[model samples]
Target: MMHQPMKHNRPPMMKRIADASEPYLYSAPALILIVAVMLVPLVVGISYAFRDIQLLNPFSGGFVGLDHFRALGQDQAFYGALRNTLWWTGASVFLQFTFGLILALLLDKPFYGRGLVQALVFLPWAVPSFLAGLNWAWLFNPVIGPLPHWFYALGLMDEPHNILSDPHLAMWGPIAANVWWGIPFFAITLLAALQAIPRDLYEAASIDGAGPVQRFWSITLPFLAPTIAITVLLRTVWISNFADLIVVMTNGGPADRTQIVASYIFTQAFKRLDFGYASAIALVLLALLLVYSMLIVLLRQTMLNKG
Candidate 1:
């Protein structure tokens, strides 16, 4: 064969391998940190669900298998917590989404002092959860706050009494606080999605003699369906797990009327020193959330297919 031109020297195979792996090497620390911080704790927590892990017990490391689950099945307090969780999550997500949609719609229109209005409305979301709970608790108090007085004046209540003391209404105290703080989150997210919709679609719909309601039903609703679905799902999960307000405001008091599963878990873990039982309850909650999320996703897929 004719003398071939000498091939240019290339990097050694080991060097090439090292070069290809350099990016991964750079990211290795963060990857290790995530595994150490998140994955390790998650695995440990799941393991704890199956073991006797009382915090104060010296000899509580034995694997008990499904014992905690069996006890949980017979626990009436857990059942009550489950029901309260449903009520709390349902009311909070509904009211937040409703008022948030309204706020987003209102803010979508150009107006004077729009920025100021938006900032004021979103202020509650910026407040710390503990502070928000305290603020709302105070507001519900008749001693220094005006809400009870307002309710009394409106004849909703016979006297200016704190609703947090009433078992029937204690859940509503945290729910109201949750709704106020969470509304801004939904408003911000939905407003962003609203702004992303093509203005031309609305213009075209208007040209076709579509009124506001018709335009909303025909164009706006469909565009917002995906965002609304995702937001509602996320908010449902978050509100279900949110125990800060309940803990700070009521501590699941009024005879445990305000106790949701999350606060119940807290009660089990810290108050009762039953870490294993708390982990079991958390595992159950996680399973329920997974199932609920799956159902929602399937429903969304089916609706999209039909549409």
Candidate 2:
């Protein structure tokens, strides 16, 4: 009597290929939709950046070289728009991350009414941007506005403060509005990350006689570093293009001190009816955004490597 040899059993490579192909069998439609809807529009915008587009008719425009970008080099308004855009990006992102982190840290602690406070704090994010902007726009109304009334009551103003017209305050006002509208989103997102942290780590730190600050520096921040980096990246992108809030609130008035790149581009294209020039502005903005996005990816990778 002899034991029979076991037969080797394995699917052929061709069968494996057929199995993998099954998933793509249903993905073709989605692929088509993505290409047609997203890729086509992006390609068209990129193409226009190289053309002499007109407001009257985009198709009738002729091809132009890099004159648009070259023109931007000599334009003062473009420079102003760039400066304001930088200010907006820097201030809004910094404030959003700072406040959001504070809220997240506070909410991370155990307290009564924690759930209610979190839900209430996140309410600003639920409302639409335009609506929130409009609400702030009204609150700053010079004569009848609550802001002016409160300032007067507190002896902070001899007269009503013209928020929209004051060069010093105009930009900050919009920044405040945007931060208010944006904070809750960051809070909720960061809170989720905080909650995902392991309790055992904290317990171990406590057992080692670590103080609140020591435990936070060693355990908390390191764990939340990735989340903070991601939040900064996302907030940067959104805050950079925050035009609806600005436009609805101030329309970039008072000698255009508060005009951001997006609103400037809008005014140039739609208000001035100079589509070619506006396209150039838009192309420049696109370039900056691309650079920022790349920087974000690099920073994220660096942070990830560190942790």
Model 2: which ten-residue window has the lowest total lDDT?
Answer: 1-10
Q: What tens-digit string does per-residue lDDT give for candidate 2 at 24-77? A: 988989999999998898778777767787768746578888877788889898
Which 10-residue window of candidate 1 scores lowest in summed lDDT?
1-10
Please report the candidate that would top lDDT against the real structure.
1
Q: For residues 1-307, what per-residue lDDT tens digits would candidate 1 score against the true structure? A: 1254536566568867887999999999999999999999989999999999998899998999999999999999999999999999999999999999999999999999999999999999999998999999999999999999999999999999999999999999999999989999999999999999999999998998999999999888899999999999988998899999999999998998999999999989999999999999999999999999999999999999999
Candidate 1 TM-score, C-alpha based: 0.88
RMSD of each: 5.7, 4.6
The superposed Cα distance between candidate 2 and the true structure at residue 173, in angstroms, equals 1.4
- Which stretches in model 1 have alpha-carbon errors above 4 Å? 1-35
Off by over 4 Å in 2: 1-10, 18-34
What clash count goes with each model? 0, 0
* lDDT score for residue 196 of model 1: 99
Error of 2 at 144 (Å): 2.8
